[model samples]
Target chain A: MESKNDELLEISNLETLDNYLSNMDNSKSNSYISKIPEVCKEYPCCLGIDEAGRGPVLGPMVYGISFCPVNEGSLLVELNCEDSKVLNEKKRDDIFVDICKHSNKIGWAVEVISPNKICNSMLGRSKYSLNQVSMDSAIGLIKAAINGGVKIEHIFVDTVGPADKYQAYLKNLFPKYKITVENKADSKYPIVSAASICAKVVRDHALQTWKCKEGHEYTFKEFGSGYPADPVTKKFLADNVDVVFGFPQLVRFSWSTASNILKDEAYHVEWEDIENEAPSPISNSTITSFFKMTNQKSEKPLNTFFSDRYLSRKVDL
Target chain B: MAIHIQSGKNDIQTNPKFSNNIHSMPFKIHADCDAQISKYFLQTPIEKEILSASFRGHPLLGKEIQIPAGYRGVVLHETMKPATEKEDRKFYVIHTFDKFKYWNWEKAPSKNDPLVQAMDWIDIAEALHSPVVEE
Candidate 1:
């Protein structure tokens, strides 16, 4: 049966999320977050900025820098510096040496947002809202750089929100430094690319800490293992979640798993080992009317087949 | 040298020396250690060479940075050439420094190459965009 939450979502028009992933160039994200007077491309200081963990249902967000001088470009580039996604373990292995070997400057900031914190949020404030908070941490890193008196030429970034909102968020924090927020700053700028690697590597390690809880630890590849949709991820959740002992502290119980249990009257009856109380004062006729209304919904082709509507749910699985 | 070097302020260059004292620089992480950088004044190079991965003028300039702890990705220095000429890949490096303090790349160490070692430090100097190393 459709829950009230499902009804609210249907009316919200928030379903088809369109990020800046496909249309990249117009993305104005650079390392800096303010307006910069256009200067010669030959200028020495350049900032690259980008972010990770946007749509995942779990895990903290991250952003960082792998920047050097224009002249060091050959050496840094010799590190085969590019977006983090393009390289694999073997490739990142070779490129990382060249990147750091030629390094003149490198700095990063990591905010480890706990899954418990996400689970504790009041209804309607999904992990997306918390990820937005993590983006604020990136602004902290940038502000730290500028406060250290790092003069930057141009800032490149992979944007996450309405460009204007993100810009405003940084304005009070960084009175100086031009800001450009866009998607895929990873592919467009080398510093952002390097930052992606640092951020990715950091978050990937964090995910590993919680990989094995109660025996039967599944070794997950270094990636988005936090989301419930991952096969191994779902299995991890299935094995670790013990409602009898209260939900696993790391799992987001406000999600469908918990919601489904709450709605299943039969589960409550069997789980509590309770017999049904006397019929409600509303009478059998009224209860029948409620069932009639619900039955009508089940008759609809879209809602009837459990498998047909399964993919429509936002859960990664 | 003039290639990749820049003029940073003087106050930012005071190097903190070990007192021959037991407790020295805190193992604690500093965002960018200005004191460590101050010890080694990075005077700009007079002539430019092919870019390595370093930039002298970058605002967060620091020399105290620990080099790559190990190698994950590997590539030739010449590969930094724009991808239009050949296939591009992720940048990585092999560590020459055994005592890197912070950044962790030590996961996978590789055998060394005679050619890379034989290259003149002058070329390596130019590639990283710095002048001659005091050491």
Candidate 2:
């Protein structure tokens, strides 16, 4: 994933996303892991895992894994890669560059789960919840790192769901490795911090260049970090909702924010009503029945038709 | 007169609370009629109703009616008997809103015209299904 940054620099380039998303089959889950090589020769290694952009209503959620020799803790200290959320974008980029420089000593992997994929999984008929998807992504990164030949002896993860259950799940997955899953593990462990930086940097890049595959030319600046709470994002959503079609492909329609916008602002035709079946039958009008009548004995047509059928027009209570 | 019914929820099927039971909402229908034309409005904006009705009477009547972007609902057409047997029969086309869909579109009308035109009925149906459909 480290070499992948050069392509990311070209924000509009579809190839950057392609490189990051290469080799994904799409038959199983929406996420796939990309691995970077390990630099250290140590017998035992510690792996730290963390994620970024999980809460945002926009953009992809990324899970990252970082590993290094147990004794190479000083290298992470030199990079000052801790609490990526607090670091400015420039600082995070700088720390990421440093990690890339020490690529031989530090190995990392990341799983980028796109916004469209997130919406699909969350809104799927099977109801693949976001938490389950996130768990799968975190575990995927760890598995990718190990399968790529990194000697992972100890694992530390920043938690989103219940920590004990998550930790136990990981422990059962790999009984040979020591696992710790807790909140704030990114700030507490250097490897987790590095992983957090990796995830955050990758997600930032992905969002910055996000082009709605649906052909919408939207940048992250237009959406303001893809967070529902961001005023600019809220305004963007407000300004672009389509009455008939709803929103562009960029939106997660399943999210309450998007759904509410559709309910409140976009058109809402009931496509499926058992009572009102497809090719909605024409309303049965009294005028039509009158027109159908042949050879009326009355000299004049019914002038009080509207008044006579007032009760018929009233909807049944 | 046009009346707006403010419902806090969307599709009745999507939300368990909003059942299939139809509530008698506040409804007002305004009518406009002339020698060659008749227009009926049910909560649809006066301007749009008049516009579509006017278009229906134009020489380009058979061509797709120029519905303003962001508006969608039923444009019902029914044949009516003329005053005399020799007189040409009349085609009555009434433009009415599906209260919820029309008002919702009124609140937000930012869709691109060509994009909506390109979308088929299937796209609209899938979108209305409360799921994200790929283009």
Candidate 3:
């Protein structure tokens, strides 16, 4: 336990956290886990899972899980891991540090799903929704904890979308373990609050130290809390938009706020697949064809080969 | 109007080298703008020969094509505009390329692509303009 605390203590510092995040590729999701407590492997543990930054249009959505012995649920409350929404940034960071300080009693992990990844998944051809991404992350964390030798016998998760559906799904996956899923589980359950705090602290730091893959540097104040309603975030989106590329990787391009801005500010771009999906206006009616033929000129039509490829003689360079 | 190319200062190299860095997108942008391709357009190989990349959050598949033999590609830049309609514009050779990679949105690049098919014209044009041969 002491050695685990020493290892975590080094990473608890903000500088180390920044280094850890900056070293990863900003375009993909990443996971980080603390060393499993020896006690957790020996005894049946109750694990809590929660997420943060899910609503933000900027920055990464983070899923965090915290686990301790089934009997030591009060230890989380003692560490001041209360409702993360009620806690400020400083309070969350302090709680996270305290959680790390008591590493022997608690262990946690986080999955940072990058904004670029969110946009890519949602806008992909198959169209993976945000809810699916969240569910996958939650499932991944639980699997990772179990794989890392944690004897998890009870699981609690803060709900995404409908609570009943999520609970049923998780129960199906882990039938041996008792599972509870509820709205506001972070506030109702001390273990979940600890998980929320872990997720929140990591997400806040991730936004603060975000290095744009486009080689642009920006402060948190510039993008604000990444909510679409934040004027600072809106201003940042409006100001930094490229006429061709739209926003950088920090902003979720699939979000309505970003897409709306792009529709107005950036040059119009049409993808072949998207364009082909639209309903064609031409009609097959004989009357309409007769009327169309009456207005046609007596000239030769271009070949279909050139038309299909959109090839044309260039009039100018 | 005739355009005068300043070949003395910016001579076209006989042995021109080309970089493999190239991309073709399936979307049309209605404006001319500069892009930071090297910084944002990172690519990875998804299969043995197929490459994958993304453009503005959309996935793209790419393949490289070599220029046909006995031919070279040149890039021309219009250095200066003519002061009058009758005056000739000045032009220069900026760069040359022998091969480039083309990309498609979520689709594999193939010979059926318009650009790839355009290369077939080189051989057809040679055949059309060839001198008559005596039997």
Which candidate ranks first by lDDT, i.e. highest? 3
- The fnat of each candidate, in order, is 0.00, 0.00, 0.58
**Candidate 2 residue-wise lDDT, A1-317, digit = tens:** 34434545321223444444433322113443333444433457889989898877666788888889888888898889788988999898888777766766887777777665676566433467888888888877777777677777899999978999988988998899999999999889999999999889887877675555334576667888778889988998898765544555456666787778777885443421223235647777686677686786765433343333331232223
lDDT (Cα, 0-100) at A118 in candidate 2: 71
Say what the interface RMSD of candidate 1 is.
Answer: 27.1
- Best candidate, TM-score-wise? 3
Question: Residue A108: error of model 2 in Å?
Answer: 1.2
Q: Which candidate, 1 or 2, has the higher DockQ?
A: 2
lDDT tens digits, residue span A1-317, model 1:
33334323211111110111111111012222111212212345556666555444444444565444444445445556778788875565445444433333443333344444344332221223544555665766666555545566556667766766776666555556566666677887777777776556544544444432223243445323666467655555554433232233334444565334333311221121124366548534665575454534444333323332232332223
Structural similarity to truth (TM-score) of each candidate: 0.42, 0.56, 0.80
Residue A91 accuracy (lDDT) in model 3: 87
lDDT of 2 at B63: 13
Instruction: List the candidate numbers ranked by DockQ, top first.
Output: 3, 2, 1
